[model samples]
Target: MRILVTGGAGFIGGHLAERFVIDGHDVVVLDNFDPFYDTRIKAHTVERCRERAAGGDGSYRLVEGDVRDADVVAELVEEVDYVYHQAAQAGVRPSVEDPRKYDDVNVDGTLNVLDAARDTGIERVVLASSSSVYGKPRYLPYDEDHPTTPVSPYGASKLAAERYACSYSEVYDLPAVALRYFTVYGPRMRPNMAISNFVSRCLDAESPVVYGDGTQTRDFTYVEDVVEANVTLLAEDAADGEAVNVGSTDNIEIRTLAEEIRDQLAPDLTLEYEERHDADADHTHADISKANDLIGYEPTTTIREGVWKFTEWYRNDRDWYEPLVLNS
Candidate 1:
């Protein structure tokens, strides 16, 4: 199999690219190395991919480019059997500050990927959607049928991008499936995420800050589970043109999660709180039954376990990666 992973040098994209190569599938990664997060983090992921390819039967190649460039996207899509569109401007708070940038990258960049895949005989294009599309949920454990009233520009852009994917699947006979992800975290995750921040602060002997009274809940999915969901979709056809939840099917309160990370190193450390951002949702839980039915997806990592695993990785990684994250 030949696979093309956009944003393949970031967290999830890097995992997918390396996994595909390890499974003996030729993989090509396309990323602009956007400074949205630290470029050094992305550089490290690219190096990981290269090292994985060094001993594997499959080959890995990276093309440094932007998805917004139609010519670049079309060229890359033409070379792959499958497409994993994972590139986008991420972050809710930042989106609040600059909505148009989100629109241009999340919306227009996605349009470029979908449009390029239209006639490329691509087997499947897996779109990385988000649970944020379901604003202030009408009910708990949001199903595929939940209303998509995004509260932030980031969510709105994801919703629009996924809608375009569905339209292309319907009108252009494109095979695309949108996976609406809950809060995803794991090794090499963005440093600004709550888990990352909490773990970092605890390591530095600082208080873990939780905004908005710390009562909110989140269905945090581990990166490995999300990678499995995408890989499973490679052989399944039942979910084409549909949005399915890729989550752990469980949730945790913000304060509880913060404490869990804090206790790993600073059992006596106290948690701090502040007013929550308006764009933040009070809670998020996913009904992953649809994903199970469509692609045999079942999350194996619990929040407690995931947090512990992340903390362990951070303890070792921060020695080298922290300086880059801080400098960047």
Candidate 2:
């Protein structure tokens, strides 16, 4: 199948693109190479995907453009069998200061992608939603039925984009599925995220900062499982109009996560506590039963295992982590 993955140059997007490409599918990546962290990292992600595809039977192409560009999105949609809408302004704390930019990219940008898919006769679209859309879950193990009272603009925008996609599915008969991703972590994870920050600080033998006593809990999902879910969603016939949670059922506190990383990287490094960022949720545990039943999705990496994997990647893969000076 021919697949077009927006934000294919991003951490999660790049991983998903490689999965499709390795499966002998024609893959086209649409990315703006946004300066979210460093354009160099995004460029490296694209390069990795190209290299992966080059040695395989599949083909890979990169479309350097924004998801907000209607003409570009429309043109790309016309050439693909499926659309993986993963592009957006993704940082939570940053969104608190720049809500409009998040809205423009996450909300308006999504609408443009949906429009392109609708106009171009693409049958299926897999959207990359976030667990932040659930806000502070009133209950443990957040399910698809959980109320979406997003706390940050970033979460709100992702929820808004999901709604827009659902609306398009209803109004335009565009087959679509929104996968609400939990905390995704792995080798190419974004540097601004907790795992990357902690790893970098540890590598530099500096104390890593923790916010709000670091008690917040999260269900960290691995990149491979996330990519697998996307592939399953793209191929399944019953995925349309469904919003499923994709995550490992295991939940760990932020403090636990930091400790794990510290143990794996540099146990000598201490932690500095700071006030919690308002945009962060207290706890997030995805009830992935829906994903399991619908698409046979199951997370394969444990937090301890994943932490080790990430540490190894950081040490070995020079192509992934060159931008961060974790301790300021």
Candidate 3:
């Protein structure tokens, strides 16, 4: 199979591209190497993909392009069996500052992917949606039917993208599924996320900052499981025109997460609390029953175990992860 992963240089995309290569699928990674973080991480991802393909029957190609370019996206879609659209401008606060950029990258960019996939007759298109679309949870463990009242532009963009995928599937008979990811965390994750910030601060012998009195809870899904969810959709057609939640079995409080990472890396450091950022969700927990029933998906890693794995990976890659901003 020939697979195309947009934003394949980023964390989850990188991991997914590598896995596809290992599975002996010829893979093409489409990315613009957006300097949201250091571009070195993306270079490293491409290197890892090369390593995966070197001794296998698979091939890897990295195309330096933007998804907003319809011509580039069309050409790439024509050569692939499946499309995993992971490219986007990610972050709540940043999107609040610049909503139009978010719209251009997340909404318009997604339209390009879906349009190309429709024209090329791709097997399936898996969109990377976010739990942020649920807004301040109406109830615990948000279901797929939860009303999407996103407070931030980032969340609104994701909701728009996912809905477009669903609409494409329905109107154009294009096979597509949108997975609403919940606080995904693992090696090489976005440096501005909560887990990364906590781990980085703890490693530097500084207090792990907690926002909003440390009571906010998040369902931190492991990257591997998120990858599995996408891979499962490659062969399953029952979920076409649907949006499903991809998340862990449980939620952990921000304070608890900070404490756990601190205990693992730097027990001497205490936690620090700051006022919550504007447009941030109060809490998020996903009801993945739709994913389970539709695609037989299940989260395999717990938060505690995942935190350990992330800390270990960060320790090794600490030298290269040059995050642009601190206290994100």
Best by lDDT: 1
- Model 1 lDDT vs. the true structure? 0.91
Name model 2 segments beyond 4 Å from true: 318-328
- List the candidates ranked by lDDT, beginning with the highest: 1, 3, 2
| TM-scores for all predictions | 0.97, 0.96, 0.97
Q: What is the lDDT of residue 199 in candidate 2?
A: 81
lDDT of 3 by residue, 235-297 (tens): 998899999999996898899989988998899898988999878777888898989999999
Candidate 2's displacement at residue 33, Å, is: 1.2
The stretch of ten residues in a row with the least summed lDDT in candidate 3 is 319-328
Backbone clash count, each prediction separately: 0, 0, 0
